[model samples]
Target chain A: MMNCQGCRDDLVAYLDEELEQSMQAQVEDHLERCVSCRQEHDSLRQSYEFTETYLSSLEPSPYLWTRISAGLRGEPMPVRAPWSWLAARISNSAVAVRLAAVAILVLGVGSSWLFYHERKLTGQARQEMVQFVADWEGLDVSRVNPFLARHEHPVDELEANPFIDLHHHDIKNPFRHEER
Target chain B: MKRPKTEARAEDERIGELQEWLQRSKQQDLEAFHQLYQRYSKRILNYIYRMTGSVADAEDLTQETFVSAFQNLKKLKDDGKFESWLFTIARNNVYQQFRKKQIPVGSLDAGGEEERSEYERIAAPVRDPQEEALYSELQHVVNEVIEELPEKYREVFVLSAIQHYDYKRISEIVGRSLASVKTDIHRARLRVRDRVKRYLGQSS
Candidate 1:
């Protein structure tokens, strides 16, 4: 009673002989009655046959065993190029470890020097700023106080001073025109 | 096809010999390990060649596989499963090579013209000229379709159809579930069949 779709779906598994006996019988009955399904099965089987006939195992090179045996024994392969041999040597575990250690040491020393240089510059700048502020604080304020106070007087008090020639110099009426 | 009882018995005897070799290999016997290599290297090499589509890469990967196998011989738990174990190593090496090189799966360029020519040169034999030409053409088409399949499907199909491993053994070799392997093989077969049919129809 398997439908065409169902039979087609299971056709692959059936071909592989993976289906149960009862299901296998069902597919068989379906194939007997169904021309389309039978053709599909035949085509699939033919594909399998074609593939098996056409695809064959390839032969490995004769020297493959020699290369493998040399590898297992930790000997360098004879046919490697000079650069490749050098590369292989560079990639050895001990060499790599030594290179890594040297790189780390250089980085550590460089960073420590940079850190110390940066701290030294910061300390010098801080000391210069402090010296500038201290010199400013040590200045004589008494000499500067009178100069500061002179400018603080009112305008009228300054007009009454003898040394201040307000009328002669026309300090207040500088813009006025007079006949005399 | 069902194998004859004699043939099956011979196979069992061979398996027995392989186990004995494995035991000695684990004990650091170089000669015994070499025997194992002589028995399985061709199959491993071909499996990798099909996977990679390049004989040069296959040779390199096969060497790596056996070297790794020799180093890890003591770690193998069951000597009886050596075939599957060896295949697993080969599969891992192929994948590792792919990963390191960032080669995309099913790349058309994987089988370069040079490699293809090399393959034909090595695989060519003295035969009837007409049949040889036809077979060469069909093989070219088949190889193209196989290379076009996604890696997952290609591996399963190659193992099942080319290597003739059963679904259970294939699942073990590829480290996939039996159900997944079955589905992949079925789909891969259908794809290949459709392509080949199309080619045949056109050629006729």
Candidate 2:
């Protein structure tokens, strides 16, 4: 039974569902009969929907993440390196942490490389010695005996035979040799 | 007169998950912190944009808000109220910006935050571009109406009509009594609808 002007005053409250049940029923009944009031209610409702959707749907420009990350680093990002994107995002203190990580990584790889190379060289050396031993094992000492005899110094021969001791009578072991 | 409990229970579970993330973030788990950021960034960004009425200003304030939050996250005592706390920080960030600019914030008579260019920049990725355009234009008029409202009314209106916050929560945010918040929200709606009525008349 409320006039349009009375209904207009209650419109916002009714839309918010703040009115009493009897009042709400009255507004509803009025709205059903009143085309203009109903249209007004519907328009308000639609506008509210439009406001929510429009404002909430906006997104920042794509490069905003880059800018935020750069700001975090305490470094100015003039040019972005794709490879160092994560590196660029870390803070100043974290830069030192990253440097330490890189150092550790280099040390690990360098140490492994050195170990592998040394092992490879050792393997090669062992193979060469094995081949030399096999080649010499056949007739080496007897054939070298004649050659060794021709160039032998008595002092050298004495030194080569570790059992012979020419000095130091107090030495307890007979296998001890001259110092030279 | 018991209400259906599923939605409330679901909200509680969501808060619990956020609490877990927040706890991990406090422990210096960057990934957990990033998860928290991902969960909230868009909403926070949007809120700031609305408050400032400038996309650039909103972006700057959003970053500063997160930076401040990141630095002082340990100060937060309650995990369940994280959104309220975060939004309070966002509000403060906007407050500080206005303070720096010496913007007279108390002038409730000074009308309307800007609403068009910022909105125009957004490209809706939906299939019907026309619907998106129409929606955007409708929103432009609606937002202008919202912005034109007085500050107190605008705050409650945004929180209730736009953000869909409960009256209790809106009251808490505005630091107003529940009745005042309700009145302001009602008044805001009336003003906005009055302004947008012409557009609505044409469209309908």
Instruction: Grade the docking of candidate 1.
Output: incorrect
- Residues A86-144, candidate 2: write the lDDT tens digits: 43333234565788899899999999998886556545554544344334334332232
TM-score of chain A of each: 0.40, 0.32
Per-residue lDDT of candidate 2, residues B35-127 (tens digit): 787777776776776666655566678777776777678998877667777778887887788788786552321112223343445565564
Per-residue lDDT for B101-128 in model 1, tens only?
A: 8977545343344455554668677779
Candidate 1 residue pairs that clash: none
Q: After superposition, how far is residue B119 of candidate 2 from its true place, in Å?
A: 7.1
Clashes of each: 0, 0
Looking at candidate 2 chain B, the ten consecutive residues that score lowest on lDDT are B106-115
Q: Which ten residues in a row have the lowest lDDT in candidate 1 chain A?
A: A142-151
Summing lDDT over every window of 10 consecutive residues in candidate 2 chain A, give the lowest-scoring window. Answer: A142-151
lDDT of 1 by residue, A1-180 (tens): 899988988887788777889999999999999999999999999988887777655776667788888877789965532343333434445665787898899999999998786566545554544343333335333322221121234557867898986555735331122335
| lDDT comparing candidate 2 with the true structure | 0.66
